[model samples]
Target: MTEEPLPTNASSGVVRVGDTVRRPAGPWTDSVDALLAHLHAVGFHAAPRPLGRDEQGRQVLQFLSGEAGSPDPRWSTTDLGAVGRLLREFHDAAADFTPPPDAVWQTAIPADREDLVVHHDPAPWNLVRRPAGWALIDWDAAGPGSRLWDLAYAAQTAVPLRADRPLAPTLPRLRAVVDGYGLDDAGRAALVPMLHRRVTAMVELLRSGAANGRRPWARIWTEDGPYWQRTADHLAAHTDDWAAALG
Candidate 1:
């Protein structure tokens, strides 16, 4: 297919050409492309492979066909577990990837500590549910971050640690995911507290994006920020309950 716009994405204007995706080039694209190539060289199969640049000078990536998640997803327990396991694989595989010299990323904030190159934003929305397994997309936000923190962000967004959604229903799946990820007691204890911090940063990002007139983030800020603020509060309040369950 000639480069035609794909179905609307929440974040950016991306296009599809034949079996590849063409995205706008950014300052950090070189770093991202190098990282993906490294992941491939290191034998991580779930991430996209970078093809040569298209005629439009856009970055092209191999199109991985599968399902992406939405705000309100009805994922099966098996799907949740699979996502968890897949995330663990990605983290392990990416543990040693070295980015290009003088690399930079679209980081919201510098990681507290660089454990490895993390898909810093692995929320359900950026994941593709493939028959082979879950594949994480959108490396735009990927960068150096703590492994546990990355997984915690993913779990919180996927399990969606929140107040309106009943704790009993979400907790079991949360535990299942943590178990599937093979997280140790220490990781489990830290997950909830980290989630609280992640969501707080996310809320700030939303508000800031709104202030600056960015897409989706602006809309999300107006429409959903309050609910998520409440969710952050809930996570902070129930850290003990979560730790007891997962720890």
Candidate 2:
């Protein structure tokens, strides 16, 4: 039987083979494979399972079927809470994973083995909306990062920090995710700063990728990066307001 070519927003080759997804392997593939195995061993199956390589050397992962979450779904508070909880669980499962001294990652972020591993891009696009719940799909960027680093990135995606909407309306959703994740006062206090750093790094990453002629990155850089920059700016102006929303 022929393998089905899969449509992905990634800037890489992907295909569906039986119950798995086949993608081109990179130098960082082993690290990702180890990361997925760790997630599974720790009972976090919301991510794809690594099933080894195919005949042509493509890395095979369990195919998580379903559409990506709607761009602007009417997310109930419950749904927001669920996402936060899932993310927290993911971070917890990654807690005991011992990072390799020589571990290489797909991204340029130098390995900080001390920090918790992160999904890096656990946005709606990477989530597979199942009947049961949403599951994260891509593991290409999974690597060492802290809870604040990960959660802060998540806030950009889930709380949806953007200049398009007023900060007040989005703060409640931000609070929902933070509360759901059980982030305490200290963690909450650290969030806006992390958001600033995360967005800044992401903008540089996307801009550099585009400059280097990377696709999707090149395609997304103009719009996605700028919006996050605007978010960072808005947050800078109303950091206290955001804190008020949390309280």
Candidate 3:
């Protein structure tokens, strides 16, 4: 089988072979596999099925057929809503999952709470759109996390709370996402703050990683560090505005 390399910003050595995606495996792979299996078992089929490993000792996953990125129109109101709904389904399903006794994960950033396992990196780059529906790929980052923590990151990327983009127009899209997730009043209030924390954490991660000479993080920090720092400041500045928008 021809191993075609998959383009990704963070990880390298990912390739598609026939109907499976083969990628580097680690101590965390078993735990991730268990999480995916549980998602499928609970009927949250938007994730790829874990196919064990390939002959090359790399982890194998079902190669979902679709374009990987933000949906057409790129963060249209409808797509944002779908992203929220899908994330909700995944979180709800994950709530009942039990990690293996020896489970290990690659959670770089700690969550406010470990209520359940979550797709820590549910950004637009990891989302895939197919004829059937949307699917989130790249489960390597799957691990213990809070619902809002995961959702905040998703909202940041999908709604794209950037410093440069005007906030007025973005408010409706943020509302669309929160509403689609069916977030309650409590969740809505908490989400505003979580957005600031999540983006700030990202900036800190990049900054520290670069200082510590971490692999991809160090590399990415060199390129996008300033942008994320500016976005974090913007999120902090607009806390009240975000709260109002969610309301």
Superposed Cα deviation of residue 38, candidate 3 (Å): 0.8
What's the lDDT of the predicted structure labeled candidate 3? 0.90
Top candidate by lDDT: 3
**Which residues of candidate 3, in runs, are more than 4 Å off?**
70-73
Q: TM-score for all predictions? A: 0.92, 0.89, 0.97
Question: For candidate 2, which ten residues in a row score worst on lDDT?
Answer: 107-116
List, residue by residue over 144-220, the lDDT tens digit for candidate 1: 89887788778887887778888878878888788879988777776767878878888888889899998778897
Q: Each candidate: what lDDT?
A: 0.82, 0.78, 0.90
Go through the candidates in order and give the C-alpha RMSD of each one to the true structure.
1.8, 2.3, 1.4
* Better candidate by lDDT, 1 or 2: 1
Model with the higher lDDT, candidate 2 or 3:
3
lDDT (tens digit, per residue) of candidate 3 on 86-205: 999999999999999999999888888998999899999899988888899999988899999999999988888888888898899989888989999999999999998998888888
Error of 2 at 141 (Å): 0.6
Q: Candidate 2: TM-score?
A: 0.89
